[model samples]
Target: MKEIDFSKLIVTLVQPLVQEPSAITVTERDTERYREYVLDVAATDVGRVIGRQGHVASALRTVVEGARNKHINAKKIRLVINDHRH
Candidate 1:
């Protein structure tokens, strides 16, 4: 199986929804049971990314989860979104 560039995928998905594309950041972390992707967006753009009632976030997770299932055979994957605070 090919290695998935989850960080880049996440950035690509999130960039269009934010006011400052350059401020978006995606970090990956490995745990015992799951690989986590932490997506941090600008504080002002947090709501836009999250969407009303979390619909946008849910869709993002669904897509990433699908990619993991299709392209990788390893631990479960997680997507976490946060606001980058300065």
Candidate 2:
């Protein structure tokens, strides 16, 4: 399998979300092998990205996991949504 850099993968995946006009910020955290992403966006855009019952978030996690599996010492990926309140 091809090698991948976790940090770079994260930045690439999250960059688009922050580009949206209603998006506030994207924060990322890496701990050991796991990575956590928090996206702050306006309420309207939140539904657009998150999808019904979180299908979009699930898909994002799936993609991240696929990338993580190609790397060493990586296991978990998480995405959290904040309604631009903080």
lDDT by residue (tens digit), candidate 2, 1-86: 76666445645665565436534556778778667767666665776567689887677667867766635535476766675444
Q: After aligning candidate 1 to the native by TM-score, how far in Å is the CA of 83 from where it should be? A: 3.9
Candidate 1 regions with alpha-carbon error over 4 angstroms:
84-86
Question: Taking the tens digit of each residue's C-alpha lDDT, what string does model 1 give over 1-86?
Answer: 67778899999999989899998888889999889999988899999998999999999999988888544547877999985563
Worst 10 residues of 1 by lDDT: 68-77
Model 1 residue 63 CA deviation (Å) reads 0.1
For TM-score, the strongest prediction is 1
